[model samples]
Target: MTQTGTASKTVFGVPVPVALFFIAMMLPTAVSVNLGGLRLSAYRVVLLVMILPMLLDLVSGRRGRAHVFDFLVLAHCGWALLALINWGGVAQGIESGGIYIVEFAGAYLLGRLYIRSYEDFAAMARAYVGLVLTTLVFTVPEALTAIHILHDGISGAVGGPMAPYIEPRMGIERTFGPFDHPILYGVFSASSFSLAYFVIAKRQLMNFSGMAKVVGVVLATFMSASGGPYLVLMMQGFVCAWQRVLGDVQGRWAALFSLFALAYIAIDLFSTKSPFHVFVNNFTFSRESAYNRILIFEFGSAEVARYPLFGIGLGDWVRPVWMSDSMDNFWLVTAVRYGLPALFLLLALLIGLVWTVGQRKNLPPEWRRARHAWAFTLFGITVAAATVHLWNALFVLFLFLIGAGAWLLDAKPDPKKGRMTQASFKLPFRPAARLF
Candidate 1:
């Protein structure tokens, strides 16, 4: 899709975004990825997750300017077909493939919606940073009140309810930093600061106060005990800021993102910081959580064997209640459930996007920073997935950032041209199509 007048794109008759949204909404209900720690589900629901994102493209008329991001959807589509006939082991493969689709599409859709413009992308980054800051400040108290801290449900005793905060691990209770879980907190925080750091290093953030705000956000993410998410996101941020934002700047913004990352690690390592109470209190591996996805995939191999290709049918993974409680690594899970071919297809789709976004010529310095920020943000998401689900609200913020960055690149030259003036519709994306 090359960007033009709004026209409803669809296959048969369903709007892709809408359909996928429904499937995501239904996924948990139809089949819990965690079946009381058994980690087995009905495969049919998984299929819906796979096919849904594609519908987004089919319905977008394929000529829409934002088609570059749509490449991800294509990857999922390939996974779907591969799963369908997965080396003739179709059943288990389809279900697993379906599940991954839900996770991937959820993140992508948010990117399409919120990141529709440079301003929106920047706003999302700021907001995420703000969230991290808020959590950092709030966690101080949560950390202070020993008894009230661990003996709780939602979180925040002296303050208000933090709907998205979570502390899955025992010792260092990662305060959702902002969205859902510690890992998610890590993902969101990493993406948030990565963008902020890029902007600052490249001078795109502008002004001393804004730069300070960006730093504050990055610092907050550090304090929250997110583990792996914290480490990886920092590296991705560094690479992006250096290549995309800095261009040829000496030791300034070019390496700013990395510096922040290093500083964060240094503080965490040297400081007497600890989850403190959680460390003294309960500590269980919770092997059933995101940490044990590998186990789940191992068990799923047999299930896939039953349906080598084409899958058990076309649905979520249906474990007969007695299945083991283990989650698969995204790569293996895709193959065992959908087939090896589907996994390859999925990778191709993502790699293609990486190639397209990585190419840029003589963009203005500021625009260049913005571009690198989004590109790095996308790559970072890919890396972050290894540890946690990418769809959590925290990481989804990056999706918005990328969209905004793209919008900035393609923004209308004339203020009045191609822009909707009405507050009722002109926000972004489907303003023309949304009016219906």
Candidate 2:
């Protein structure tokens, strides 16, 4: 939906600033340096490198008046740090909590500062597409052979593999690419589905290049062979299709919401399991996985009840000895790891941003389309997080996208040209900006 423009600043054709973040995420976690007992991975290093400039932008009010969402993010990070300190003591807390701050708040600030307009958002999407496509070179083969070429190469060079080898599922190898798990890779790829479709495809279903990007996204997600990523793709696909078919209908989303509420209520009344349990059972790859997640919610909530203010931090959660330590639900894990306040702040940030962006009015057609794409992507991800846990790079990326969409709230309509322009922010760095 972005208008044609000169190319933006790029490194080897990918957009800068955001390019730095995406490139760092694409690298293996094994690629890191242990500096003074703190391990700085590529993404962490990039976040640290860019933090000062981003803070300067925020302090200067170059981006815009700070919104409640901004404070919510900061508060979430603060509470998380406090919880860690409460559990681990000051020194260990700072060491661990500092990493979360850099990865979460730092990545969010990068998106908030750098992507300040539609063109900027488009450039970010293009950079993501390029990165996903590049990874396909290794992912596709890894999926087929179960021999992670990129990870193997990095492991050999770095002295060990960061991600453990996952056994094949349904006779096909689950490929994680550079991430620590197949679900993370799948989620990373699936997050781009709507962006590629609406921004790259430009709402034209028949457009070859756009469709190619969509197909590529699906292929990459499929390589992960994980139910969580598959769920993301399906949710985005359904939302995109609903938009396409009902774009002309007023209150369509409201009607859809009503229908969903009715279905949820009906399921809650009739089904022996709660709606969430039923949903998880139907959606996962196996009943065992679904049952485990149910138990996670049961025991995980009990733990939360015990430590309501500051969670157990990195300490082990109470569960059956037979149960694995892994907590698959991201939202639950946040509450379990930190506290309810931390989880509440995060949910508020995510839901608040999505609501504010979607409620913006009088946008030009292009900007409106872009808003839908961004909002829909986040919506799918918000739901997907309940089914899968996000950590490391994927977690940073999830927060980054929330920050990236904040610009939409500040878009003002230009009366003279009947176009949408960023409010209170001037383009600080623009170098010729092309999407393709």
Candidate 3:
């Protein structure tokens, strides 16, 4: 029995498979080895491997309540296949689409299956913290030497360069360590800042250890040296400040968001320069570097209009010759690649997750706190997605959170019993079918 009262088999309070999953997720590249022509990433491989338990449960006839988001995820995958087909070749489509199916579908299903309780959510959060800490082992050295240790080995293992150490930006080489990019490392580090603080806020971690972990995450974000992550950090700080200063944040958050959206629209309509150009020019000192992103939106709008239904195809957008095919914005990118319906589904999924957080009055105290924090975190990610493509490790990490949120939303504590029974697979049926 664990904190959530589910019968958990664990080596040291943490379930063995869950622990292995976290290790695989956290050390995807570090544990990776090249086999002939294939570079086997531990993270990707482990995510697939983790499917075994769920399959076994399915074979054993475990079923739970299905949420709207579940269908949306599957639908998203279907759209992905269609988009890949739009790309041109059936073989290439399967090859490209298969990985995505693994990540979006596989990760989501894994989360829904395993992370069925708050205790599981908490364990995963701790594992995320562990993962972040582990990266510093390599990131610190890379930062000091201006060299990435994982670069040569990972590339050689993959049979090609996977994460080439790039030239320094602003005279400082960003340290990504084992991650694919510095921006990804930075965004991931900044993303975890809120989760780390959540543990402290809940009084889960204490004294020197907790403070040190928080400080380490802060430093990691700084070492990333990317503007996007810096913005995410600032957004998180603002969210925290909003919660502190205001007695309740919902009303004020909505008002502020509305005002900002309106202001952005107003600027885009009235100003000679579009809002994207204006924002890039004013918000970032490296205006030249951000020009491509601004162009993505500027050109992406036309692309969105062109393929309002099913998109032109995955990775097959007609961009200005000067502009690369990169659609940096998640909403725009999804709209362009998978079509508007897919984009709408993505938005529905995100909004639904946040909305689920506050929909109930009977939420456990712990879940109540999670509701507020996750709402802000989701908002921050949405903002960050505008600047970077969302198909990175950060998205994978976020999928787990979404699964947790779904669990919280669907679960209701028993009033008479005074606690919820842990949903488990019994011989013939799932015990938590009603709760689901």
Which candidate number would show the highest lDDT if scored against the true structure?
Answer: 2
Evaluate all candidate structures by whole-model CA lDDT and list the values in order. 0.46, 0.82, 0.66
Clashing pairs in 3: 65-436
The 10-residue segment with the lowest total lDDT in model 1: 275-284
Q: Of the candidates shown, which would achieve the greatest TM-score relative to the real structure?
A: 2
- How well does candidate 2 score on lDDT at residue 130? 73
| Candidate numbers sorted by TM-score from highest down | 2, 3, 1
lDDT string for model 3 (138-157, tens) is: 78777777867655455566
lDDT tens readout by residue for model 2, 1-436:
2222222365544347677788788877788898998888899999998787776666666555565666677788889999999999999888889888888889888877667677677877887877888889999888788788887788668886656867788778999788878999999999999899988888887899998988999999999999999898898899888888998899999988898999999999998979999999988999889999899989999999999898989999999999999998999999998999999998888877776677666677878778887888888888888888888899899989888888787666555432335565333233122211
Rank ordering of all candidates by lDDT, starting from the highest: 2, 3, 1
- Candidate 1 on 1-436: residue-level lDDT in tens? 2221223332222233433432332222223355442343222233344345435543553323444445555465555756555433566555555444444554455445424434334544554455555555655454344222321332344243444345534454455422334455555556655566655444545677767766766655564555456544665655754565555666554365587677667766776643321221222134444324433443556656766554433445645465443332344455554555565655664555444444444545555566666667666665545444444333234333443443442343235423312222122233222111
TM-score of 3: 0.82
Candidate 2: segments with Cα more than 4 A from true spot: 1-9, 12-15, 413-436
